[model samples]
Target: MKLRKLITVAMACIMVFSLAACGSENTQEDAAATETTTEENKAEEVEETAEALSGTVVITGSTSVEKILTDMIDEFTALNPDVTIEYTGNGSSAGIKDTKAGINNIGASSREVKDEEKEDTLAEEVFAYDGIAAIVNPANEVQDITMQQLSDIYTGKITNWSEIGGADAEIFIVSREESSGTRSAFEELTGVAEAGGLTSSAAVSEGNGPVQAAVAGNENAIGYVSFSFIDDTVKALKVDGVEPTAELAKAGEYKLSRPFLFVYYEDKATDAGLAFLEFALSEEGQICVEDHDAITVD
Candidate 1:
């Protein structure tokens, strides 16, 4: 009887050990299963975030900023295949008016919003800075001019290139139209009156390309254009001894620079508009600005 009782107790101990082992195995399996489920859920969330967003964004404004903005839009749309962007290169004033009137989703301007144009309902975002290059014909020997000299030249006080150290030739000034953002920024930077500080004497070009063409064709012509527009056709002169470069402009060393702005009405903005604006302020968008020869804002 005693041997039988001892045998029974040993069997019971073996059974308990077996049950504990089985429980331990099942607990490990359950934990592994839960970990796998959590990983799968995290992967799904990542996939959802990577999905392309869809919408249409409408941009209208400054012709000076059109090319850069278009380039950026192209890159943005490439990443988000479902999104479409339309840009209209009217003048800056028209862009502001259209934004206020709710005709466009966003207004692009190369200049900052004037105090009078600011309203509680309107918002401005500055994404980049652009240097307004003072260009002269390649044949002209004049290399640099001071801000005061530039102001005087635009104001018609210095009519000959010889007055500021150049050849004995009359200074033929080329200027953008009055409605141009480039013209506005140039006048404000140089503290010159409207019409490129001219008294109806300067030749008016409709756009940067035309202004470049006019200056390139005339040996004695001088004009201010976007830094991106400067090429072999014209020589970009240093102002106040500081070169007009995007880097210098960003560093605040270049005085003839202006902000690249996007204006919109807060109440009128669509989801697509808001998304595009966010993208425009993203790292990728700022890279696009740098690629287009503009200074990105920090």
Candidate 2:
């Protein structure tokens, strides 16, 4: 009877050990399976978030800023394939108007914001700086100019290039539209605004491209444009002996410089719009700005 009891107890102990071992193995397998599932879930969440970031962002404003902004858009869209950006090369004033009316995601301007436009929730971000180059026909002999001379020329006081030691031909003045940011900044900086604005005889172009074209096509025409827009087609004259360049603009030596701006309504901003602005201020975006001949904000 004693032997029988001892054998029964040993068998029970073995059964319990076996059951415990099986339970331990099952628990480890379950933990591994749970960890794998959790990892998969995390990956799926990340993918979903990426897929959710899709939309169209509309940007309009300064024709002067078109080149740099287009380059930035190209790079940004490459990174975010789902995000679409549409840019229109309206003048800066029109851009500001669109932003104020919530008609565009952002407005581009190459000039300082006016005090009157500062009302309400209008916000601005300075993305870059640019010097306004005073361009002339390459055939003209005048190599440099002064601020007073420019002001006088635009105000119709100086009508002949010979007045400033150039060719004996009459000076053909090219001016931007009254609503142009470039025109505003140029007039304000060169004292033309104080002199009652551009003369009536000046040919008013709607954009920088037209201005450059006008100057390039005429041997006696003079106009102002963003420094980035200067090409071999036109000759950029020095203002007060200071050359219009990104380096000089950053150092404050170029008096014709202005800030490149992004104007938007804070409350009405969209996710993609904000993201695009953030990217424009990023290092990569600044590189694009510099690459396109604009001075970086940094």
Evaluate all candidate structures by whole-model CA lDDT and list the values in order: 0.87, 0.91
Quote model 2's TM-score.
Answer: 0.85
- Collision pairs in model 2: none
lDDT of 1: 0.87
Kindly list the per-residue Cα lDDT of model 2 for residues 161-265, writing each as its tens digit: 999999899999999987788999999999999998889999999999999999999999999999888999999999889888889888988899899999998
Task: Tell me how far candidate 2 lies from the true structure as C-alpha RMSD in angstroms.
Answer: 5.9
Candidate 1 local lDDT, 113-182, one digit each (tens) = 8888889989999988899999999999999998888778888888999999999999999988877889
